[model samples]
Each structure stands twice: as structure tokens, then as C-alpha cells.
Target: MDMVNPIVLFVCFIVLSGPVLIVAGIIDMSKGSGTRGGILTVLGASTMGLVYWAYSAISHMNFSKGRVLRLKGRARVARRALGDGWADDATPDIEGLTPWQRTVLGEAWLYSAGMEHASVPAFAKLSLKLSAMGAPSELLEACHLAALDEVRHARRCFALARAYSGLPWSAGMIPELSQDRPQRPSPAEGDDWSRLVRGSLLDGCLGEGLAASVAAEVSRRASDPVIRETLAVIAEDEGRHAELAWDVIAFALERGGGTAKQALRQALDALETQRSPSLPSIPGVDEAFLARNGVLPQAELGRLMEECIQRTRARASSS
Candidate 1:
């Protein structure tokens, strides 16, 4: 939060990435994207071996997993984005790139598009959760803005995917995201405070903290100027999102007393899961090419994830 405390805001951003990838894979399978689906399924499951060693009550509103609709052939819809500011519709130059190269980048961006698109609804749901709890206007407003940021993010990623893949596709519908959404905490539910605490800790702090770090790192290393800038923007916004989670967790702890504190303490055990990278290597992808295009290898990203966890531990100890 604004001040240092026993609980730190720095948590694993990619801590839940394994599960997300697995969920994405399942969705991919449903969409008949066997190549990505199979890969995501296997890697996601294995990554969970590193994760899911603990951290029960992982679903604070089921974490809002989103689905991407893979449309049939060249039918693209017109996109009305949040606004035309910065890289709203920017695409990387593919002047010297091969078709296969484009396909690889496209696939990577497509997956990223799904993740970003899902976040749009996730933030909207978070705002609902805050409103039911009667949170501050600032928090509520931030959620709305974050949702807009995600919308822009999804748009750009989809555009990049379209450019690289040479496909006329955009984001698909996500009815289930709203349908199975977590309801606001009714008075009868009673444990709303705990839910808020854990949700912010795991999802907001850890998740976005790791996200900000990874995006920044990827942006820094990426050879493509447009990709670098796009990630830089995402990195900055995700950093703010991480801070919002910190503020939310801090506020909950202050108000919810032992229940909230206890929730936070329990989620802290997630730090112990910090060990080696769990994901297997991609079979046909060239590591250097992917890196140049802004896609870091799974193992390297894992290392960055572990580093974030370690940094959190150090900061917690010093604080």
C-alpha cells in the first residue's frame, strides 16, 4: 500500500500463469486448435506441478477465465477500440519476415490476445466485487480504467496476430465470463473480507507484479520497435494494477482484522513454491527468433517469475 507493512505488494505475476495457460489450452481444444491446444495443455499441466503444490481457495470468483472464439475463414469484424491514442492499432513491420515467421508471431500474439481480452471482463468483475464491498470511489474508478487498458491491449494483440497470421480475425465472444462470474458478496456469505484479501494478494499483487516485470523485460529485449512499445505500455499499466492490488490488500487487512490478515498469511506460502521452471520447450520454434519478436522462452520467463518471488521475499524481510 502507501506504506510498508508485513505484507508486501510484490507477488508472483506469473504464479497463476500455468493454470491460465492450461485453461487457455482447454479452450483451445474446444476450438479445435490442436497444435496450440495440445501444447498448452501439456505445458500448463506440468507448470501446475510447480504451482498447485498449495494455495487453496485459489478461485476468488473462479479468477474469470476467458474464451477466444476462433471464427471460420477470413471473416473479420470492425473493431471500435477504447480510442486512437498511441499504439491502438500498431503492427510490427514484417518486411524481412517469412510466412512461417509471421505464423509464429501470429500464434504468440493470438494467445496473448486471449489473455488480454479475458482481463477486460476480469477487471469489470473486480469492480463489481469492490462496489458490493462498498470500496472507495478511487478503487472503483481504477478498475474501470484498467478494463479500458485491457481492451486496448487486446485490440493491439489481436491486430498483431492478424498481421502476422494474415487472417481476418478478432476477439470472440465471452458469454461464460459473465455467466459464471462470481457474485458480489452478499451479507449472508460473511467471508467477503477474506475473499477480498486473498483475491487481491494472489490475483492482483502477485499476478500483476509478475506481469509488469515480464512485460518490461520482454519489451526491453524485443527487437521489434512496435512490439517493444506495445509491451512497454502494458508493462506500465500492469505495474499500476499491481499497486492497486497492494492497496486493496492493505485496506482489507486494516478493516478485516485477523480474518484478512490470516488470509494474506496463508497465501504467502505461495512464495515457497519458488523453485525451477516447469514448462517444457516448444518443439519446432526457434528460440532466438521468438525472442527477437518479443516472445521470451518459457524457461526464461520462469526464471523471471522466480526472481520476482525472491525479490518479494527479500522486500518482505527488510520491511
Candidate 2:
């Protein structure tokens, strides 16, 4: 409401309506009923009209006479979360990721990295959208950063999956990252431990365990020296990642309130039900890699998962 230049307000209207139109068009395409498509088209057009009307009404209001008070709140929130002021170039270069790790990590990471990469601007674009809807700037900035991290993690995991599958990494059908869409207003539930575990435990701990298992098995099975060496290196990293997850969970539990404790318990329960993403059907992947690496037994993978679970459980019990 900073009496945003009229042009900025107009552009915002377009940006907000674009997605609604895209979805309506998709629904129209899916319908074989000619009448259904017409109905959807009408609905979409009506939505666009409503949005334009609202924008026009707000734009004409005198925001200078304390009518713009909401804008001040949003700016304050942004300052709190983004710190000092927004930076034009806040993107950080991720340098330590090995090329192979970057490639294969994407496949495994797609499951949860939307949440993980919540820090990225791409993911946070929605939060920026909400800021326009009267959300504080700090909250929007927090959302933005969270989306950013999730997207980057997705990129890393996809890179790893590509190497494993021998297919070039692409976003393809990956779901767009989400933040604050569920509309929980309670602070404690929003901050709960179970959500923490769901967000962190699988990837941080069990996921790493699977990686290590695959690596160890690959070392035993692979005849090709390159394959063996690659698995060995990747496995080492997975092991470290799993350990890091455990440490983080522990720290979160110790420092966190009621939500963290409950969430940890639930996360431990989920570990029992966890399964790895099905290995892609690459040429010779079954015989050349999985069988040789002892992953064919499948039970071995279960055992590795169990080991990770036990470690997590023990940490929780101690806490």
C-alpha cells in the first residue's frame, strides 16, 4: 500500500491472475464435454474480472491518510526476516557439492526438498505474493529463504539421480515448492516437533543410511572400477549426511519446546514404514549395479533402514 506506483499495482494484478488462467485452461483441456470447457472458461474470466475490480477499488483509495498502515507492518516484517534491507544479489554459491552428488541427490531429494529449499526466491515468490496480501515483510522473507533452500536442494538431488539413472536432470513433473498454504494459526502447532521430524528425519537420517548401504553394496558388486569407485565416494558422503541429521535432530529436540518432542516421536514411528525411491530402470542397472552391490536382496536395504531408525530412537530416548 506504499501507494505503490500505479504501474507496479497493475503488474501485480497480471502476475496474480496469470496462474489462475493457466489452471483453468488446463481443466478445460482435460474435459471431453464441450459444455464443461465453456463453463470453466467463463469461470476463469469471471475470476480475472473480480481481481481487476478489487485492484481498481484499492488503487483509488487514499493510502496516505493512515490507510497505508498495513504497508508499514509488511515492511517492518520484511526487515525483521530479511535483515536490514533486501539485497539484489543474495544468492549464495554452493561450492562444496561434488558434481556427482549434485546430480544424483535430486532424485532422492524431490520427495521433501520443496520444504528443504523453502529459502529460495523461486519458492518464496508465493510469500512475496502474500506480502502483497498484508503479510509482514519478515514473515515473507522467512518464507522466501525457506523456498530458496528447498529448490537448491532439489537441484542437488536431481543431479545425483541423473548420474545414477544416466538421464540428464530436469525438473519435469516435480511439484512447485509450497509454504504456509495450510493456514495454521496456532503458534505451538505451527512450531511442533512432529513436523520437524517429518521435515528433517527421513532425509537427514534414513535417507543417508540408504545412501551408505547402496555405496557399501556397490563396492562389493561392481566389476567396473569406475562404478565401484563412484559408489564408494558417494557412500562416504551419505554416511556423513546421516550423522549430521542425527546431530541436528538431537539439538532441535534439546532446544525446542513441546512440538519438537512430540514430532521426534512421530518421526521415529515413520522410520519403520520408510522405503527408498524405486531405483530407475536404467540399462543393466539391475544386474550391473544393484545385484552386484547386494541391493537385490532388498532385505539388506531394510536392515540399513532399521539401523538408522534405531540410532534415531536411541537419541530420542536419551533426550
Candidate 3:
């Protein structure tokens, strides 16, 4: 059986429960409950309904309705006998792409694939750190799954690159996973918690949050069917990844006290200072063509970046 759409389920919950809550709140007030309690209940119900409506409208505007694309095949990372680190070696045969299109697609896919590979080590580090801190099993499991997701992302991106370029693409040497990895001091016996908090804030919350926002914007504007579908899938996964980051942060804060909170605030401020106005534009790339192919134009990218920064700052301040 096909799964129910989460968006539909959430909307139904809001619509059905909202009125019931409001009416019950009103009746409670009439039956002599305290004014403040009743007012809070009614206000909460109204807020939920309004928020759901607004979110639904915005999502509709940004995401086009289409049948879900089923992804097939598998891509795996293979170690080069003469080189260090793992790379995806699978190359599928594809036809009909022009040289220019091939170049654009190849570069784009390679960039994304490389980032996905990089994420593997990053997530692995996070999982180990969380494990050291005795984090709950669920969070640990999510971190492990996230690493696996990055593997899948790298494979899919490599496949796309190969298809477009009509040549094999390999994930080049990644230093992080190399056998000659740089030696670093272990996390101080008691400092693991602090390190975890900082890493989650910088990598998970800020980095993944920005990634998800950009991916969603690109998917929304993409004209190519393959590009749109692939990016949509990536955006959905990135959104969940970002949420997991925040969840980890919350978990840390619950036990981390004021020190953790202060560290997170400092991290946010530092990230804001390091922010760029937009994603860098590829030289010699046609803006119109990039837009058509799911690449965001510099102007739109800048606008979206600004919006994401503002939202992030707002959340930080409120927290």
C-alpha cells in the first residue's frame, strides 16, 4: 500500500483538532474555569490553525505537485588500490546530452557528490562523539542512518554525473578518511559534551539548515525532470537531517546547563559573521541555463540566504 503523505496528515490534524480545542476552551470558560487558562487554550488552538494554514500555503508555493520519482540502482564507494579514501566507481551509460550540458551537469554533480562524501566522515565523527556522551539510542541511530544517507547521496550524484558526462566519475581523495589521518588530541574526559554541542550547532543546525533551504529553493525552480526529482529527494532528507541536528542540540542543552547555551549562542554569532551574501556563481555558466537546470541564480540565492540567516537568528534569540 502507498504511504500517506505527512503533509496531508498534519493538515488534517490541525483542521480537525483546532475547532474542537477552541470550543472546549470556550465551554470551560463558561463553566467557571479561570480566565487565564481558557484564554491560553483558545490562543494555542488558534495559533496552531493559523500556523498550519500559513505553512501549507508557503509550501504549496515553493513545491510543485508531481508524482514521486522512484530511484533505482545502487552506488557503492570503492577504495582505489594505489590511492587513499573511498570513491564511487559506478558509471551508467547515457545518451543525448550536448557537450555544454554535459559539462554543467558533470561539474554540478561532482560538487554535490564530493560534499556527500565529506559528510560521511563528519557524521561518523558526530556519532562517535554522541556515543561517548552516552546519548540516547534513537539519536545515535539517526546519526548512523545519516551517514548511510550520505553514502546514498554520493552514489546517486555520481550516477547523474556519469550519465551526463558520458564518462566515469570518481570521488577523488578525501583526506579525512585517509590512513595517514592527522593525529589530534582526544576530547577531554569531561569536555565531550561541550564538543558535541559545538559541533551540532555549527555542522548540524547551521550548515545543514542552510543546505536544506538552498536545496528546496533549487528544486522549486528546477525545470529538468531528473534534476527536480533528485533535488526534491535530497531536500527532504536534508530537512530531516537539520531537524536531527536541532534535536541533538536540545538534548545537549537539557543536561549542559548555561555553559552549553552560551557556547551555542557564540557559535551562532560566529556563523553569522562568516556568512556570504550568496552562493558563488560558476564562471562561464549561463544564468538562464543554470536556472532551467535547477541551479539557483546568484540573486535568488542571495535572497534565500538572507532569509535563512534571519530565520536562524530569530530562532537563536528566542531560544
Clashes of each: 4, 40, 0
TM-score of predicted structure 1: 0.68
**Best lDDT among the predictions, by candidate number:** 1
Question: Candidate 1 or 3, higher TM-score?
Answer: 1
TM-score comparison, 2 vs 3, better candidate = 3
- Candidate 3 TM-score, true structure as reference: 0.65
lDDT of each: 0.64, 0.44, 0.61
Which is superior by lDDT, 1 or 2?
1
lDDT of 1 by residue, 1-319 (tens): 3563211111122356678888999999999899999999888887665434322211111111121121221112224222223134677888887544565566567656666777776777678878887789998998888888888887787778666765545665554543363456555334878767656766677667777887887787789899898888888888888788877776777778888776666667767764434444343356677677876666777777777777655643332
In candidate 3, residue 179 scores what lDDT? Answer: 41
TM-score for each prediction?
Answer: 0.68, 0.42, 0.65
- CA shift at 240, candidate 1, in angstroms? 0.6
True-structure lDDT of candidate 3: 0.61
- What local lDDT does model 3 show for residue 290? 67
Write the candidate numbers in order of decreasing TM-score. Answer: 1, 3, 2
